[model samples]
Target: MRTPVDDFQPGFAGRRSSVAGRNVTILFLSALTIMAGATISPALPAIEAYFADTPEAAILTRLVLTVPALFIAFCAPFAGLLADRYGRRKVAIVAILLYGVAGVSGVFADSLFTLLAGRALLGVAVAGVMTVATALVGDYFSGPARDRFMGQQAAFIGIGGIFFLTGGGLLAEFNWRAPFLVYAVAFALVPAILAFITDVHRPEALPKQEDRGLISGFFLTIPLAAVLLASVLNSLTFYLMPTQLPFHLKALGTNSPVLVGVAIGACTLASALFSFFYGHVRRRLDVSAVFALGFGFLAGGLALVAAAGSFAAILPASFLVGSGLGLIMPNLGSAAMAIAGEDNRGRVAGLLTASIFLGQFVSPLVSQPIAERTGYAAVFGLGAATLLMAALVALGLAGLRSRRQPA
Candidate 1:
């Protein structure tokens, strides 16, 4: 095999890439990235049962995904800085290869530790997809085109979630390891990204990257911490939804794979619809308000889920929760990227992605034990509280409203 340097160049790929091609790359690759997390959540209960002899196996199910998240959170800013200095496609391709291998590892692992190892590694790869993918949108695609892709990004997340959640359920019937193998599909997108994509314009001057001392200073800002917390809290809801809802629904007597799949599928559909509407809605409402409304729905939906004692109740609650998520996440991308600024866009988006990865990494762990100890209802309660807090934070930040028209 030729060395990586032999096949790719290090100079600017024009600092941006083609909108149509790049957006397709971002959407499909991100769908795969999001699928990695979603597919695993539904497989957890089965994996735990498969390894029932070790109680800890179930507790650390989050480890499979979260371990990688730790690396993503730590490495995201660095990925951004590299993208800024080097070029987007080069770094992205490397990260994706890592993602593919780590994801594929799940199919063949023998032990719980081995499985966690795969997930952890996959998390690192995912960090690249998350960090660089978002930055790429800003790097290549712009204005309506960028916004549409971002909306589609959110939509694909829902679509991918449906594909994986039910598919995960189906795979669990065969073997717990089978669902994770699905992540290997990411490799196919590599060729598309490599072939069709060309540079687009990078945003006008971004913030100068911070040095080691300034990086420390950067973390100290109240706004920075708030954004990070907001990101964490946000993922806590989005990631935990798939992880926790299945258990809650199962407890309520809707244990059929078909219904469970439908429930997960319905959320994705709702999310798709919300994503479609966000552009117009976002135009009328400020980013912060849109965020708050989305989160407010999250709090309400979780509230309903917490009280639900029967499977019939889950559908409406799922739609509401998914709707809130759909409304908030895409717009959050635009708003947060704006805050991160141009030069440091990569770093800030990287950090934000990291925060999200960490939150997603930890989210299932946050609720699984709570559900195990207290009950599924408690898990929903915790989700509601976190989402409620997110709403308040967004509402407080309403003052940061931009004069620029909606993206």
Candidate 2:
């Protein structure tokens, strides 16, 4: 079975030494996508208070954390299309520049609306960064190498989340705007991206009728739909930590932003640790079984969150949630990439990225009103129940697959 890497071997034959640098650069770029939303999560309450005079300040302030997701969801497919038509490196460079400018623009905004506008642009930038970066992983590697890189990529993003979330929390203690300064780090990565990242050359286009049929068929496949749906659900539930946990903690008598950061960082720390071992885990379990295991952890974690009485209790809960995410992240990427040919890898990656953020964007929208009416515990409880059901469905699918296989 010839892999994507085999096709490019001659071109890369002399560039073996550069592979490490390329992988590192792509991993660094992956961090930026998660940073788009999670970094400022601790500042939500402060932003809400600062904008008390604004209409619907409570909802809008939460949107400040999630609004970029909305834009990323809407714009990611377009970004992917551009990357597929043009080239990944050029799109990535431009996106990284936009990310820096848009990210920092929040620090200067005097109004909630302006801050959200900046966040929306940040989403557009994230769409480009995330889509191309994932596509590059598919372009550069195949088989076990791709699987290993996906795990490493997820682990790196989790590690980045710990730093940004903790740093943002501490900064929020000083001023809500302080966390926005973290966006400036995107600028530093531009030089590395230019030096190390190279775009893959796409094969010649198929005939128009055949191309359209193949692309349409791929999009409509059951496996692809399942992966996309699972990605959306996984993100929607995982996002509850950042969007709702701080307020939940405050309601439980923990009001410090630093503590809030630490609580959220616990989740990222656990995620990083578990993701570091994802390749080993994947070697033993099929993707459906992995999903079952991951969602089970999430179900257990959210249940703990709903029952917690103190801030300390949230740490263990966060760790459980992170473990689930650690597995699910790589599984989603690997599954989607497995189905993607080089011609549409960018579009597939873009769609998957969009689904993940779409869930993030929708998380607050779905959870907040429920929390407002039923309280935070009820919201977490309902999420736990939903995830539990998902876990069972995945287990059943795994069982069905096994039964169909020959002894």
**Which candidate's TM-score is highest?**
2
- Clash statistics: count for each candidate: 10, 0
lDDT of 1 at 221: 52
Q: Tell me model 1's lDDT, rounded to 2 decimals.
A: 0.72
The per-residue C-alpha lDDT of model 1 at residue 164 equals 83
lDDT of 1 at 217: 46
Candidate 1 on 3-47: residue-level lDDT in tens? 212233334432345434555777887786667666766666676
List CA RMSD, all candidates: 5.9, 1.8
Candidate 2's residue-wise lDDT over 1-407, tens digit each?
87665665545434766777888999999999879877899999899988999989988989999999999998888887777777888899999999999999999998998999999999999999999988988988787778888999999999999999999998999999999999999999988887777666453443444333224655646998999999999989888999999999999999999999999999998888888899999888899999999999999999999999999899999999999999999999999999887677888888999999999999999999999999999999999999999999999999999999999
Flag regions of model 1 displaced more than 4 Å: 1-19, 142-145, 199-225, 396-407
Q: Which candidate is the best by lDDT?
A: 2
Worst 10 residues of 2 by lDDT: 206-215
- How many Å off is the CA of 221 in candidate 2? 0.7
User: Lowest-lDDT window of 10 residues in candidate 1?
Assistant: 1-10
